[model samples]
Target: MTRTAILVGITMNQVNFDYSMEELANLAEANLIEPVGVITQKIDRTNKATYVGKGKVDEIKGLADYEDVDLVIFNDELSPSQIRNLEELLEIEVMDRTRLILDIFADRAKTREAQLQVQVARLKYELPRVVGQGEGMDQQSGKGGLKNRGAGETKLEMDRRRIKQQISQLNKELDSLVAERQVQRRNVRKMKSQLCPLLAIPMLESLRL
Candidate 1:
């Protein structure tokens, strides 16, 4: 199913703002998202909290509500707080350009290595954004006993740990793959070195004659 989206951007002395927004729209379409509208603000700087001016955010919210857009995509990478704030205010899914590009790469990844690299990048991007949620993190529960280390860990904590572990594992795997390629390349060079002497023998004989 094609999801409708609205593209938003902030132009802060950017010479290629129009081209970047156009590329963002193309990216959305590539990810099976239909861009229904475009919104841009000419500002000296982005809002620290919302990544856009408050008034611009309000206008985006209204336009999104009216257009019934399923998602709003920003032309720049947004901080986790910005994403959280925008989603809260707009009541819709929000994605930044970095995430959109990653999604496209994920979808287009045909090889295992490509997929793993994408996963690694995504996990790294999400590592810092992981935060505790609701009563799950606050409530103290002792399923084993009273000696289970404080509140027995929250879902957010677990998520962060899991992502870190995955990132480490993926990095190791990527390194191993790269090492294997290097070894293969060395072997190929060795073979080429041996073949070069053999080929040179005939050329040298012809030159002597």
Candidate 2:
């Protein structure tokens, strides 16, 4: 099923705001999220807690309810506190541009190596966000149908040390895959080198004939 979302952006008098928001919508579409509404704020700075002004947050909440959106996508990378605060205020799932991009890569990743790398990147991103929000994380993480949006509640249950251990393990597996591929490539090159001489003899015989 296609998940619907509300796109939120802030323009600090930047010229590329429109382009950035449009790209965010495309990214959302790539992840099978239909953008039902857009809310923009032109602020000198973002609210420290919610990333948007208080009034804008309320507006987003109203729009989210009206559109029945499953999530809200922010144009910029939000701090962990900002994410938590916005979700609490809006009573909906909240995600940032960084999270959207990560999810896209995770879903499209085909090979084991690529999958491992994406997982590692995701864990690193989730680490700080999950620090003091363990209880909340359990309630929200991986609660939806969006694939690869969160690291799953089980991982969120893990302490920082455990998450780091997982990241280390994933890196090791990636390294092993790289080494295995290197060996296979070397063997292929060696076999090709040996076969070239025999191939040259056949060509020489044909030339003589």
Candidate 3:
């Protein structure tokens, strides 16, 4: 069985943003998730909280339920609180702009370095507003025991710290690889320049220089 997804794109002009949204839908299809429906909105500016307006959210939610979709993919990045709210109301997986694109990137990151970078970025984005971490802060503050002490360090915090460390290490490795590529490029350029001078000598002779 295949999972179905829907692309919900909201833009000021349907003509202006339609192609990008369509491309995204294609990417979803390539990943084996069927993008069976689309919801477009012409808005002045995207809502900061919801990206799409509240009414549109409800509309999309209903569409997802009616379509029996596994996920609703938004075209813009959403706040952590917004994701939480939408998940609570929709009772389905909610993926925002960045996460959706990163998922696409991860799928095609055939190189080890590229794969590592994608994972680091994904975890960094996902660590915040994770379930139980943000919600338990207030509850933990009220408890008066050693177990509760430093309990404000939520699971998200632990994951965030671990992600940061991994990112740092990956950055160092990527940097080394980048430097190696630069040297390779330099070598190729040098060989091409040397060959060009030799080729020019024969051409100049052919012209009786």
Give the local distance difference test score of model 1: 0.89
Query: Which regions of candidate 3 are displaced past 4 Å?
Result: 127-131, 134-152, 179-209
What is candidate 2's TM-score against the reference?
Answer: 0.86
Candidate 1 C-alpha lDDT tens digits along 92-157:
999999999999999999987899999999999988777667224443455544456575766777
The lDDT-based order of candidates, best leading, equals: 2, 1, 3
In model 2, what are the clashing residue pairs, if there are any? Answer: none
**Per-model TM values vs. the true structure:** 0.85, 0.86, 0.72
Total clashes for model 1: 0
For each candidate, the alpha-carbon lDDT, in order, equals 0.89, 0.90, 0.79
Q: Give the alpha carbon lDDT tens digit for every residue of 99-143 in model 3.
A: 877888898899877987898788778767455554344433446
Candidate 2 Cα outliers beyond 4 Å, as residue runs: 132-158
Consecutive 10-residue window with the lowest summed lDDT within model 3: 133-142
lDDT of 2 at 179: 100
Clashing pairs in 1: none
